[model samples]
Target: MAGLAAAALLGTAFASTDGLARTGIFGSPGLTENDTSEWLNTGAPDFREVVESLRPSDLPLPAGRSWQPVIDQQVADGQREPARMQATGVHAAFAHYAVCVWDGEWLAARQAGDTARVGRAVEVIRGVPSWPIFVENDGGGTVDWLRSIAEAATHGDEGPIRQHIRANCTSSWIGVDQ
Candidate 1:
């Protein structure tokens, strides 16, 4: 049931982004089957799912593009409908891991005192869509945490945020490797 719901939501999402022809397994435009698997398995979100979660068919954030506004808007909007953010492994789970890996990179760069990489990581992390995380529960708090953690990456540490993401997101539905 969860997988079917995910498929339906993805079908609508794909159609909204492009057309019916794009609705397929790992058919989120630039994201290939191999790319999706590699990214999810490694916890590293590529250009597609990280920033382009809502519109996978579109290009990723270009150089110098800031994800602050998008993040702000998502946090404000709070959680979406269950059908819209189906709690499937491919979806909520994949998105969760992508965020974890992206933030993990930021925390690592901060620990290593790599200012440049830390800055770059922050930019990337800001784009992660929070809708999937909402699938784990409800309220704008989930979204707010994502934004706050992105900010924390800039000025403080995010080890605790990682624990929250992991404890909340353990991969359950479709599209997950486990």
Candidate 2:
């Protein structure tokens, strides 16, 4: 089932601004079918399940080393090379990792009733400067939507928040169906 979803998404060709159809997996240039298959089989986690079953113990330490630095460096490089910014797959890769981490933290905080942790996660989500880039790259405002959900989760019962996540969040990195 995952493979089918991945194939459906990754198999389709997208037209570039230059009016040419580029064929590649996950909208990334030079990605072969085997590469996509490997990612779908191993690299991509079932994020829907992850968020649904989140626990504080499962969360990454907020102060610990994170992928933020790598993401930041990618954005910095994009600044130097505008073409890199135009690469939608790169942005998706960054968003995939960042959102997974942020969502885990947010969900875990809510589960533990840790308002401070929740607030911190929300702040970080909101402060991500690459949000606009994600949107431009067809990420569909996922970061912004997650931020709003996190903000709302801070106010009251977390049941609704969890439901929202379950309903909306999917493993986009592997092209899973939402």
lDDT against the true structure, each candidate? 0.41, 0.41
The Cα error of candidate 2 at residue 178, in Å, is: 16
- Lowest summed lDDT across 10 adjacent residues in model 2 is found at 35-44
lDDT of model number 2: 0.41
Off by over 4 Å in 2: 1-61, 68-86, 128-130, 138-144, 157-161, 164-178
Model 1 residue runs over 4 Å out of place are 1-89, 129-140, 165-178
Worst 10 residues of 1 by lDDT: 38-47
- For each candidate in turn, the TM-score is 0.41, 0.41
Clashing pairs in 1: 89-173, 89-174, 90-174
Cα lDDT for residue 149, model 1? Answer: 70
